[model samples]
Target: MDSIDLEVLHACDQWLRAGWRCEYVTVVRTWGSSPRPEGATMAIRADGVVVGSVSGGCIEDDLIAAVRENGIVRTAPEVITYGISADEAHRFGLPCGGTIQLVVEPLGAHSRMDELLALAQRRVLTRRTLDLTTGAVELAQGQADEQLRMDGQALVTIHGPRLRMLIIGAGQLSQFLAQIAVGLEYQVTVCDPREEYRASWSLPGVEVVHAMPDDLVLEMKLDSRSAVIALTHDPKLDDLALMEALKTDAFYVGAIGSRANNARRRERLREFDLTEDQIAKLHGPIGLYIGSKTPYEIAVSILAELTAVKNGVALPAQMSVEHGKALAA
Candidate 1:
């Protein structure tokens, strides 16, 4: 399913097109294990209708009620917080007594949402800085270093680009990986030079590139939020592009092969002048050790490991392989 923020952003764009006054309410910060992350958002209408959510259903319902009852619906742009105490948590469905801050800004023709949409479309890393004092918004170049100022007032927020992935092959495994990646909001691109594989490839919502893998990686300028996975297992095709991707800041670069083949791939990369650390980042035997036998099962394993590394989590040596199959059996 599309994320709440993405859905709200889509609704906001539609509202703008229809010329209705709308406000974008974003969850800027959370004190504890909140329902959503820092960039969570909801779009509210003048009539108190809301789409998307910053918390569980209760908090969204309260926000909707606030629009209908509170006078701020007609007054100005502002920020609000909820679930600060045990009572408030009970009322808002926050499991652990926590709080979440939201930034509610009335939408306008000059809200810079077009830029945000454009950045999201291209999967470019864009950072938006909101000046609470002046209520001004600034779009930065990228998302590496961001500063938020919540000091005393309501909230200061930043929205970073969604992580992206580029799979160098359009095989069955790539199809499975692409589908899962899209659900996770990764803009997926599949590259394949082999006509045999590219011709039979068919998957919705994934970009199919017929260019040479190395050229595609270079042209795309794989950035830090990007990931490159080689699924073809063909050295001539996969290794050429891997050499180029390793030089870039792509967060995760991996290939599918056996443990012995992984060793060989490392030796080849080292010969290409990739430093020890750079070559070490390449995750081969790509998936966690789930004993995956089928292409789909293997894809799940690879994506699980990818997610772990992406979130800066240390995954166990054994992969999560029991997703399918009869657990009772």
Candidate 2:
């Protein structure tokens, strides 16, 4: 499972390449209340096929109808608003009389949709610029500020960064962990150089890498939105990667271990010339203290904690195994 945004973009690219006319709808902005966020997208093919979503299913039907009846194929890239009033909200099934703004553009034919999709497929962040005048699209590689504009449109759309996750082991636990991570909008990779563990590893969409963990970390070039999790408890496998991770802006760096082991691990990292600031970024005893007894339960606990941290929630020390260790005896 690739990230949702990636999957959607991929589907859009595939639809375009199939020689079918496609409408790419992106939610640029909303007011009052909306089912989806500003960056939400939905792609519709000529046969009324839809992948992804902007508003709820109700709004999608209307868009499909427009594509089929009103010759929306010729509409070009334009901003459209819907459900701004109470009556309109009920008609469109938008909860709380909310308003949604959609920027609909055609796929294929000299547009940068395929290029942007390819960039995202390769785990690269590319910005797409839309010409409000002639409905032209250009893919911007490298770094530049995002810009959006639509001709007499309701919202400006800017496709943002892609999501990424690095799973530092190829084990049963890593398999479950990778699936959950992938479902939650992450481009997941499972890394393990040990052939014994690597031989059993099989995941459909996840990238499996056989490399030294630390070297792989360096090669990944993880950024702030990226995450690294060490499911392998061996210091030889996990420690060097974690040491490199803590030094980077990767938002989350965690390793699975017991309380005392995590403490010892931190002390071991201290010997590596890691400063207090760098060490502080490590998240060991890695899952929420949910008393998980099975791999599935443990995966849930880890994912829950990851989401909390991703959303900027402060983690409580009481959830650490150190706080609950007295009972584990």
Candidate 3:
């Protein structure tokens, strides 16, 4: 599935190609408890059709009403702010008197949206800079760590996957996990050397490779924005990847197993060249303990913990499988 931002871009491209006036709106800044974070986008056609969101509903409603009445009359990009006052905050439905700043750009040939869409579809990280004084846009290669920035002259936005996930197995659990990860806008790759498993693995938008997990881990050169998950439950396959993954800067490295198996796995990792902190980075027993039994439920549980870690949310010990189960016992 395409991300909301990508979908907005696609809609803008289609609208422009169809000879319809459209405007691309982006949330550049937010204050207090805003509904959406910076970089959230929406595309509005002259007929008041929209494909994405900037706030809960009130903001979109106002934008749509304006477009329907004024018919996208703007010829150049303009910045607008909402919810700056207490009454305005309540009117826009911004919680806690939140304020949001947006740049609404009139889409045309000079927008370079088609090129941005093409690059985004190919999963190429791109930085799109839009001149505030003029409608001209420039596209360049962007790093994974780049964030959206706006100054007096231009607004720069980063597109494509900013996070990646490497699953060390192509099993049923991995299939579910990979699907969810893709929907979360993560570039997901599954590596398994076993022919029997890899032969049947087929998922669109996810790259599957027939290589040893450990070798693939080394090849990826995982960074802090990357995650590694081992669901094969085979020590030979999972352990090999875990050892290499733990040594990298991957923010999350987890394996699926029981408490006893995870303990044994940790003990085994001590024999490797990994440091104590690196070994401690491994998240075994894989997921938050939500009493998940089926593969789909387990996948949800795993993603919950992964998301928490990614967002820097420190989940309580009782939320883990090992700790929760032990408390129950």
Candidate 4:
């Protein structure tokens, strides 16, 4: 789960503890353009206050009004569908026939929210299975490949940050990358063996480690959901990390440099035990062709590529900065 969903859960727990009634609303399915994705959650109190979002603003507003006017009287979980017809779609402010299905469960004793929050805080991915009939929740360990699913009888939602990132630098670019990665709900760790860089690294939510990049990569046991981005521009620090990262199931391995520099880096990696296929996986001159110059812009460009890779979207060669510049020249 991302930070927003976590916040909603925390709010629900607090409200329940305070003797206030609130209903937890989750998007189970969406059709057409949706402001929020499936598994997105919102907690609405009886007084119309809310945490998180379902359909940007309009759907949330409708939810608040309904809760305030009728009260959260549901003893069991219920599925609600919005934007069924063209008129209803316009009334709900849904874009062009967009429809959303939600599961709303009133806060009660069988919620098991405290355990779920604790598991999430521990960085453990958990599967929360909710029985729609009895409003009973069951918690269990979830795999990285699992996703949210709802059958006729129950709804299962995966909670916790499934994406992990190993940033091989603690410099300015890494600072922006790590901060944004945190907002994107990536469990980020910055590894810089140098004392000077490690001393000044002070990002609050990210973990800063004083270990060799390769050693950290080995210890992390990176999997398919993991990403490794080298921003130090130091071969000694970045190359070994790339070597280990390329050998793993990591979905993305990138390095920041010019095209020529990356070419040289690839030649250098050839001297290692890496096979040609593994070496081909390196994404140097990383990020999309946005002509980004500032640290934040560069970070955004980098994440744009990462997000594309994560979503399995392919960008053509002409879209790359180097290729575009060459064509222009």
Which residue runs does candidate 3 get wrong by more than 4 Å? 17-19, 85-91, 121-124, 138-146, 191-211, 218-223, 270-277, 291-294, 316-318
- Give per-residue lDDT, candidate 4, residue 231: 97
Better of 3 and 4 by lDDT: 3
Q: What lDDT does the true structure give each of the candidates?
A: 0.77, 0.80, 0.92, 0.90
**What does candidate 2's lDDT look like per residue over 143-198, in tens digits?**
53444444452234445456678998888999999888777878888899988988
Best-to-worst order by lDDT is 3, 4, 2, 1
Q: Tell me, by TM-score, which candidate is best.
A: 4
Tell me how candidate 2 scores on lDDT.
0.80
Give the clashing residue pairs of candidate 1, or none.
none
Find the 10 residues in a row with the least total lDDT in model 3.
Answer: 160-169
Candidate 2 C-alpha error for residue 246, in Å: 1.9
- Candidate 4 has its poorest 10 consecutive residues by lDDT at 320-329
**Root-mean-square deviation of candidate 1:** 4.3
Higher-TM-score candidate among 2 and 4? 4
> Can you give the TM-score per candidate against the true fold?
0.85, 0.85, 0.82, 0.88
